[model samples]
Target: MFIRIVKMGFNPENIDAFLENFEANKAKIRNFEGCQFLELYRDKNNTNQFFTYSYWEDEEALENYRNSNLFKGLWANTKLYFNQKPEAWSVNKIAEAQNKKPAL
Candidate 1:
């Protein structure tokens, strides 16, 4: 499995617009072929900084999504609001731990 992490910094005033766009398109993104999971996170100290953590089946799957028109449109809308250039990393999982105990 592979993970894609994107770090984005938006101008405080533009956050709402970015969020609206994400809210409208997140479901489509999550349901895209080969997408295992998707999540968004914010830096506590820097409210305007955010990250998207996504899991994919493999590099090929990731590239497929990146090459799709969906990504091009999303990127076009998202990039304009950035306070600084976005950073991204594609990585393999090294370790993970999850509880298997039943919920109490």
Candidate 2:
């Protein structure tokens, strides 16, 4: 699995609009193919800063979603509200929680 973390800093004046757009599109984004999970997080100290955490099956699936019409629309609509160039990172899960085994 792949994890993508997008950090966005928005113009203070556009924060409300950004939230509205997120509210409208969040569900659609979560339902996109290869998306196993989607979550939004905000910096408690800075209301204008937010992060989107998403999990995908792989890079190809992520690229497919990024190239889709839904992304185009969302991107265009949100870009104007950004105060800084958004930062994105892709990560891999290297470990998983497992039940402990009894010592022999």
| Best candidate according to lDDT | 2
lDDT of 1 by residue, 1-104 (tens): 89999999999999999999999999999998999999999999999999999999998888999999998999999999999999999988898899899879
Worst 10 residues of 2 by lDDT: 27-36
Residue range with the least summed lDDT across 10 consecutive positions in model 1 = 90-99
Candidate 2 — what's its lDDT?
Answer: 0.96
RMSD to the native, candidate 1? 1.9
Question: Number of backbone collisions per candidate, in order?
Answer: 0, 0
- Report the backbone clash tally of model 2: 0
Q: Write the per-residue lDDT of candidate 2 for residues 1-104, one digit (tens) a residue.
A: 89999999999999999999999999999999999999999999998999999999999989999999999999999999999999999999899999999999
TM-score of each prediction: 0.92, 0.90
* Clash-forming residue pairs, model 1: none
Each model's C-alpha lDDT? 0.95, 0.96
Segments in model 2 whose C-alpha atoms lie over 4 Å from true places: 96-104
